[model samples]
Target: MRRRFGQSLRVGVAPGALALLKTSRWGGAAPELVGELAFEGGSHPEAIGVALRQLLQGGGCANWPVSIVLADELVRIWQVAPPAGSARLADLEAAAALRFQTLFGEPTGAWKLSAGWDPAQPFLAAALPRNLLALIEQVCAAQRAPIVELVPQFVAGFNQWRAALKAGAWYGLVQQRVLTLGMIDGGAIRAVRATALPEGADLDWLAAHVAREALRLNLAAPARVAVSGHAPAAWSKGATHAPLACHLLGQGQGAGWSDCARLAATGSRP
Candidate 1:
């Protein structure tokens, strides 16, 4: 199971000197807070705090965290696993919150924000109640972002759920092990194609796969096609695939998140 929570800020402070603020995810308006500091610096922590206060006073933006709801099953798994480096879930949660505070050069109590988690998995059809769906549908309909694609992990019997999308809505295509399609009305995916490249395949072979897939989909030369996963790096910089935008692994956050907000919201901290 996975848990999700939004971030409000991540502040880093230098020893008794400078403070820097970095934005987390979940783009939105963020509230201000006085977070507690957990530090070991001699005179640095105090100096850092002063620096942070000045920085904020000078008109700086506070970082916001992304909200990600976790699945229940995943929670149980973490509970049983031995804590990493002798630290239990609680310890990690506290540390994470403190890290944000210290990074911003704030004194103890400079960057703690509330974490919100939904009990039911919002992404799942059966778990999403009518009220929530209606509320979300209305919100999504109003979005001007043009597209917001949600590429859920491929699970058995997933296609059965796609029928719920509204008409004139985007189409969903299942191509082998991957699901590729457009997310908005004006934006088109051009094509959704997949080809399996053996473990040891070279860039040339991969480019061939891309070429073949592009042709099969009859996709117009996409303004840009981003390729991600473990294999993209294998392609040469100026190789034939250069015409397309390729990246390893889809874009977003990293794989490992020691985020306690997500954990606390789901009641799964580990």
Candidate 2:
């Protein structure tokens, strides 16, 4: 049977900001953006909701599957060993809950959980707050839109450049207040650390933190570094111990959160 092309809505949610885009593909062609909602922002949830509702109403997105791309700071991610033996999803959830509780303490019952494992790689589990997700769902449903997926921005960004994450390489990504640094070995993530950057942080501070993390992780000097989301210019000037080559996302020196949102909506990574 020939498949029918359906439009999908992608929503990128970050601190005080939200962006929306509609993507669709016809026949065997690549997916393309068909519509976009103006970027919306507010300091509070009620205000943000109002903006989202207004945008949704005006965007004419009806009966479409929505995919949410959350900021890295909002999504908790962990890498763990796969459950022993043939375990069901429920078993994995149980294990994930334990790990979450250990790290965060107390289950709020307001979080959604998901876990996945690839062959010869450690399991990756992620969680999103259910209350916020429900709010988005309610808003979209009111406009005849149903949400189909929710992904963390980092995971989506990684998916965009998975081919380049070679073994023994280090990567750093900055988005909003979050700065993520990690190592990849044989295309599998070896170690990762995500830190919150203070407002008005400078390149020196960022470079220093990167160096400290490399030391803490016992990672050797990186041969190359990948940066995204408002990365400082100094990042390309060999800011680390090694004279490292740098790769910037998109055409410019940094990446936009919307790119990650679009990738999350159309690509399969998380």
Candidate 3:
């Protein structure tokens, strides 16, 4: 039988902080707050190791299923094209590796990559440091927890709210001061970029940013941007004349949220 409470644990890992929410899959009640931890430094695996170690040592989290939500900044995400009708998995992997190296100037040996493999069009690829991935898994295992998923927040948001997104709009996920933008056209991703947001940024800023990205990539800009995370209030008002409309998907606050984004959407503090 399933536990009465805390049936699942949703762990959100950002650059310098971690959030833990315990959710009951069988109940409609709000997810419970297990904990939150903040630390200094970038998204180094060592920092993540320390945070997870502390959280799991509480004893309350042991044996519960875990789902890890990685910030977009933690994972290198990019768009990959499979070179026309060649859909062989090997070819796709090679192409993704090359593109990842080109975009990040990092070798692929220390990272593990996964992508939506498709032959007809472009797909998205995500890479996470091998050591970081292993550390998460090992830490959870040591606590007798089974990991259900280790996913990027951007991919998680899209999977949960794809139907609600505008069909032709550029897609973005905003969380932890980062905006992960995905350009989709002809039912395929053309680009995936995660950029840090500047303070006081508003709808005008979003419009200009999208317009500029389109110009840089030489792709026709979408008429709207569908954002699935916490969109500021300014994005929803007084932008009808703007070149691009900011279409907010999912809730901006409260208990209603994708499990992967629950901690972020709530703005929980340590």
Estimated TM-score per prediction?
0.28, 0.71, 0.87
lDDT of 2 by residue, 71-110 (tens): 6666687765546763566666677788778887878387
In order, the Cα lDDT scores of the candidates are 0.30, 0.62, 0.76
Instruction: Give the 10-residue window scoring lowest on summed lDDT in candidate 1.
Output: 72-81
Can you write out model 3's per-residue Cα lDDT over 53-82, one digit (the tens) per residue?
787676367778888888777788888878
Which digits, one per residue and each the tens of the lDDT, describe model 1 over residues 94-164?
A: 54444434443543342222221122211111121233223322332342111122112221112322333
Best by lDDT: 3
Can you list the residue pairs that collide in candidate 2?
A: none
Give the range of the ten consecutive residues with the poorest summed lDDT in model 2.
Answer: 261-270
* Least accurate 10 contiguous residues by lDDT in model 3: 261-270
Off by over 4 Å in 1: 1-23, 26-187, 220-224, 239-270
List runs of model 2 lying over 4 Å from the truth: 1-8, 22-48, 83-88, 118-120, 196-211, 218-221, 237-243, 253-270
Q: Give the TM-score of candidate 2.
A: 0.71
